[model samples]
Target chain A: MARQPLRKVGSTWKPPGKPAGQAQAQDPAGSKGEAALVAGLRAGDAKAFEEVVLRYGPRLLIVGRRILGNEEDARDCVQETFLATHRSIGEFQGRSNLGTWLRRIVTNAALMKLRARRTRPEESIEEFLPKYDPNLFRGGPRNANALTPEELLQRADTRKLVQEAIDRIPGSYRTVLLLRDFEGYSTQETAQLLDTTDGAIKVRLHRARTAMKELLAPLFDEELR
Target chain B: MREFLLKLLLQFRGDKDPGPTEQRVGSWMLRHLPGMLTCPEFEEFIHDYYEGLLSAKVRRRFETHMQLCPMCQVHFDSYVRAIALGRQVCSDDEQLPEGMPQELVAAILLARNQDLDS
Candidate 1:
């Protein structure tokens, strides 16, 4: 009669709060009740659709905004992601966590929106990349006075600066950085998604990171003096 | 390669305690190893090394360069630190997306309903 504490629904683990009496941990489908949920989804149960939207919407919205870079586009992307998921659930095999699957859908939807919204040529990332020197240590490779992740949480200005810097990086390179670093894709996966070579992806990722470092230079400055 | 570079580092940087004999050997490697990386070359490989994408031969060369060149060490360490910081910023950024607005959810459900009817 013990209630399970947590369940992995799609890609994320959350407490099985609303769907009472589900036993977790032993079930590989992540949630003991997930099969029924999937069944309802397949059957076009309106409530099933609502439950999933409530569960994964926020995370997916983040993915949307991060990639699409605006409120209106992000909201539109989330809607399309759910509609796409609903249409494609029968084909999803349930091999991966539903959350993981949904995240991918959201990411793709955002990227497609991004491609459509390429109104002007991408801005140059040269100013954002590190200032390399041909001679020696790029001004003696300054000290790593880096902030801790917890420290980053307390620093709103740094976070805002980072957001601004990301907006500055060119689309091609920024997409690579987000996929490889934040979205946790491998170089190969990123290359495949972007239709490029692994070497190309690696180079772009490096440039992206270096550009980010340059942009956030105020926080983590090089030892130029 | 590693031993050779460590010797070279000890000699050029005058690391104080290198024995008389080791100093001679480091001096020898410095002259013999024509293919050793220059500082500029090391700069190119810093990010590659961080990503763990360098080949074994290249990695040995990369490590040797880092050890031998104090400036490059500072440079590489700085770059690596910035990368770690970038990841942290990203982790925090991920928090920005959680707690999706309820209107969006209702909108999704409503859209799904319309799709079903159509």
Candidate 2:
């Protein structure tokens, strides 16, 4: 018999009967509640699996969107993450938090999607990176102004501005910045995930960050005055 | 300080020139000797400095340059802010539950169920 598809539950539909705030209990790895949920998942409990989806799906989707930047690709990768998790549930050792584990899957899925979707050679980000005079101490003039990102925190458009600047970065470095800075992956982890060496990741990450600094100069300078 | 380090380098290469300052190089008082790093030089080390990969002696020089050189200070501050902004907007766990399309969830379950049944 073919399994039935789920009916539309509207936007307010949560996992079975659990309230919203307590849903975190179902998601955090290694917690007793989550461990039991893991057991149910391993036991092939359909409801338990649905609970996991409803709890973690949105965040994973957000991660996918941030990583892949295309709606269809992001959604497809996120869906694949859930399927992968289901297949591999019994093998999870709980060393990493469950959320972290799922995120890793989603990120990898998105990266694979990106590889498949690559249309052209990646652009060089050298022009975007910070440039200083080749000589020492003569790096232009001393500006009395020091602009910090902390000052932009209260702005309503800060996130939008930052996102737009990030969108402008070439893929090669932008991916590194997102993985190292945003995804909280260490250099070694990012290197391993991206199939690159740690030294390569470090160089790309620094260049990416330097480029971002150059790209966001307007906003930072706006706060400076 | 440049002359002091220069003379020390000369001595290490086995060139014989006695200097009181080269002896002063290893003294506890000279431990904080700030290197004369130009703005461009400091820029190169910013990544290493942030990663805590620089030796204490080098870090003192980096910090000293940053404090005394406002240009490098601005550059370094902006670099730090750029990372903060990127992280701010890309936080992994920022979930808007209401924003998740219910249809996606429906599709995922449908696909999973079909996978197992087959």
Candidate 3:
């Protein structure tokens, strides 16, 4: 059967108009196209391989950069991901979309790089949590309404500050945060990728969030002032 | 309200009047208020609270606690900001510094072809 070309959807591979609840009802044509592409990749068709690279390279690079925190390392990880994918194409079950499978590969590659590059001891997140007084409240009651995160996020500088704060979190907690929160991976997926339990992912996510908030509290406080 | 009395007492104690920012921060601290949840209790339920997984009774309790607790409110706000930052950084619209590098493609294809030949 002649295969249709995979539609170049948006920058990411999300179905354009389908709501998230309809994820189980994938577009038949799109699925057929991806199945054909997978077959071609398995057969070592050069065109199919090139198409995958061109389509997914930028997106994977962004994932690498965010997790690895630098262009050089990110590029290396993306390249490694492609190489790994090419070698392991036969093992890819059709359970997930090709893009999602590739994302998982890229995440793994980036996380490996991150682990190798880490030399510092992990830091405790306790200091980042809010300290309570005898009354169990840090600050007394008042009438000022701090801006919502959505409001602060509208400012480009605030976005940059938030990004910087994310970067400062220790790698152990940071990776869990990135995979679960940033990459939108489920706790189960993140746990599998990181080789931990879902319970651990939940704990780390909470601590990571608390630490992140601590890092940004000063900036938010400044904005409120 | 008890909070109003506390503010009055601070003034009588010859403490400088609380600044607008301090007052604002203080307003969130509902610890002395009835139905207030302690910080530890808030932390225990916060994730479930955010995810909307808590039962209605628990959710109501959590909301009541947030209403009375300034510190938990701040904690929740910061938690939200952290998630937002991650989303923004990882957003698909984030442009690569330089478009995809040609050398990367060339290298991958070369490596793959070499593997094929072998």
Which candidate has the highest DockQ of all? 2
Q: What TM-score does model 1 achieve against the real structure?
A: 0.77
Superposed model 1: Cα runs more than 4 Å off? A1-29, A130-156, A222-225, B1-5, B8-33, B95-98
Better of 1 and 3 by TM-score: 1
Query: Least accurate stretch of 10 residues (summed lDDT) in model 1 chain A?
Result: A16-25
iRMS of every model, one decimal?
14.3, 19.8, 14.8
Restricted to chain B, the TM-score per model reads 0.64, 0.60, 0.63
lDDT of 3 by residue, A1-225 (tens): 211111211122121121121112233238777888889899989998988887777777878887888989898888888888899999999888877777778888888887787788777777776566775555422222356566766766876777788888888998888777777777788899889999898888888887887777665563363
Could you give candidate 2's per-residue lDDT for residues A1-225 as a string of tens digits?
221111221122221221132112235444777787788889989999988888777778887888788889889988899899889998888886677778888989998887787889988887875555433343432342333456576677777778888888888788888777777777788898899999899888888888887777776563244
Stretches of candidate 3 exceeding 4 Å from the true structure = A1-33, A139-150, A222-225, B1-36, B92-98
- TM agreement with the true structure for every prediction: 0.77, 0.78, 0.76
Best candidate, TM-score = 2
In candidate 1, residue A25 scores what lDDT?
12
The positional error of residue A225 in candidate 1, measured at the CA in angstroms, is 16
Q: Give the root-mean-square deviation of each candidate in angstroms.
A: 10.9, 15.1, 11.4
Q: TM-score of the A chain in candidate 1?
A: 0.77
